[model samples]
Target: MGVMNELINRQNVETLAQVLGEAAPGSSWGHVAGAAAELDGLSLRARTDRISTALLADIRLMPEPGFPTAARTFRTALGSAGFTGWIIWPVSETAVTLALETGAGPDPAGDFDDCLALLAELTPRLTGEFAIRRLLDRDLERSLRVIQGWTGHPDEHVRRLASEGTRPYLPWAVRVPGIVLAPEATIPLLDALYRDPSDYVRRSVANHLNDVARNAPALVVATAERWLAAPDGNTAPVVRHGLRTLIKNAHPGALLLLGFVPASLAVTGPRLDRKSVALPGELAFDFEISNTGAADARLAVDYVVHYMKANGTTSAKVFKIGALTLAAGETRSVTKRHAFRQMTTRVHHAGVHALELQINGIRHGHTEFQVQV
Candidate 1:
């Protein structure tokens, strides 16, 4: 065996346990050890299902930045230990490793769409959702092409990734740069999968379109209008998920496209008086909205406070306005009382910070205030 392979074989669970215990001082390894031990304890004849749960948890604790190397070592150990059923030679992982080892950007894997094919095949088999997500995040072209292809895949899982992987601001995963940069690309891909036969696939389509809506609202608004007009059973719900917030906030043409079906009424845009509230301070605003439509609406409005740090990056934190479902033609006035507790861990510098209110889906109220810490 090569030296690297030998090294990987040597880095077994026992060694892994010790390194993880000390990998970062005062770092909590927690059940990470137990998870690794469970993998070590698996027998050669162990079913693929046997080691999956433990491996999934254990890999989460695995650090990034050379994570690709550690994964290779993991593969070597698995092979030498005769545990092949669980071995994953992922397009994302292989792509990462290949890039790292060669000190080059990823080359095109089989045709323009090969990466997609591999990722679709591998997403289900892999242990960690985030790792594959990171892989997709790293290779958007390949990932999307593959996902688009999978919209036609016979496997339901592949079809789901087409929608699931492209979510904007998908939690616990890196945001796909391409989708963020050029969200327009996601439209056609979503259209193909919106009516997928699988409910699993349909749910992903809803969430995916919602993801797009969050970042690029108009793109979603326009596409949703087209789908809503079609009135197809498949794309309507998918389009609705994408348009719900826009319709609630009265984004110009959204309601018109929904046949002005008068989707539940909503009130939005609270007016707050002050630019800056002093620490140990409370900010108060009066929020008012009237629903004149026929349908009863479930209304939700919230505040996003943006804190300007010394580094010039704004940190956005969301505060909720409790849920209220509006009755038809009813107008309600509500109060939002926001208390600013000085964050001790991070200090504020003197600067103008931005804050906005999101009602249903539209960002209506805006406050840019100057503050000194």
Candidate 2:
């Protein structure tokens, strides 16, 4: 990798950029030989040199817009350069970005430790399936140590990067590496970022927690329940997203939190709106339920909110208020609050959105209304 430094020098960027400028998108190949030569020149200087600086220089200096062509160039250059490990792993971002975008997949050029080392280098600059795959490739126990340490990086981008980059089944990103399939492995990482001060970061935290919700609802429910039972602003949404599917399944605890019981459950009307509320301000939804159960059952109703971004699609999240145990056969009146206030992270929108309330494990028999933003 040291031999490759020659190509990474300031002079190489100028040459590579000039080559790319002179050649049209599909015609950049003419420069590959020259660039590869420049890299090889550097490799000769060191016995350990596998990649030439020229190749790295070419990669870093590759033209941006011709995404596909540049991707091929990087892949070929990396293979030719004999990329051993992360000593050059800072280039993982460049390579992975191209590989991921080109749909070429990973080559795993180096040995096992190289994989972990690569993650340690690139996880901050690159994330999503890119990070997850590499992290999984590394020793699970050791990789986790790296991830745990990353949560505290002074740079919040890296911190937020830690969570968003690890989402299993992250679309437009790679899928989970086979080993850490279960959500348990991801818990500490999620827990650490749950209360991030940045809503941008928190939203990633919610999505990731929800990803966990898909696999281990029971555990996530406990996580959410823990936060619900206690009172913490930052953890509420995370807990809710983690518990959403469970709430829909009418988990006893989830139902209890959403407000459902034998008595006091009101003759509430359905939520009939298109499910969109505007953001940049605050949103509040108030509902009353009358419990009509004969025996004493806890009332817990959980709500799932689908938010429409300006882009014309929707993203979802879950929110929990509290749990109430209804008195046997008594008609208890319960009120639930849903807030979409500014500064709380999950913002609303001006497009079509939908909200669903799961009562006793089913969409309430009534219609749900769409609220104005």
Q: Model 2, residue 150: what's the lDDT?
A: 74
Cα lDDT, model 2, residue 262: 35
Kindly give the stretch of ten consecutive residues in candidate 2 with the minimal lDDT sum: 44-53
> Per-residue alpha-carbon lDDT of model 2 for 142-250, expressed as tens digits?
5567667778877676677677767765654546654336678877887777777878777787777667766676776676665566656777666656555666566
In model 2, state the lDDT of residue 68.
45
Residue runs of model 2 more than 4 Å from their true location after superposition:
1-132, 135-139, 177-180, 227-231, 257-263, 266-373
My TM-score estimates for the predictions, one after another, are 0.49, 0.48
lDDT of 1 at 206: 77
What TM-score would candidate 2 get against the native?
A: 0.48
Worst ten-residue run, lDDT, model 1? 1-10
lDDT string, candidate 1, 136-230, tens digits:
66666666655566678788876777667677666646666766888888787778877678877787777777777766778787877676666
Q: Candidate 1's error at 71, in angstroms?
A: 12
Against the unseen true structure, what C-alpha lDDT does each candidate score?
Answer: 0.57, 0.52
Error of 2 at 61 (Å): 13
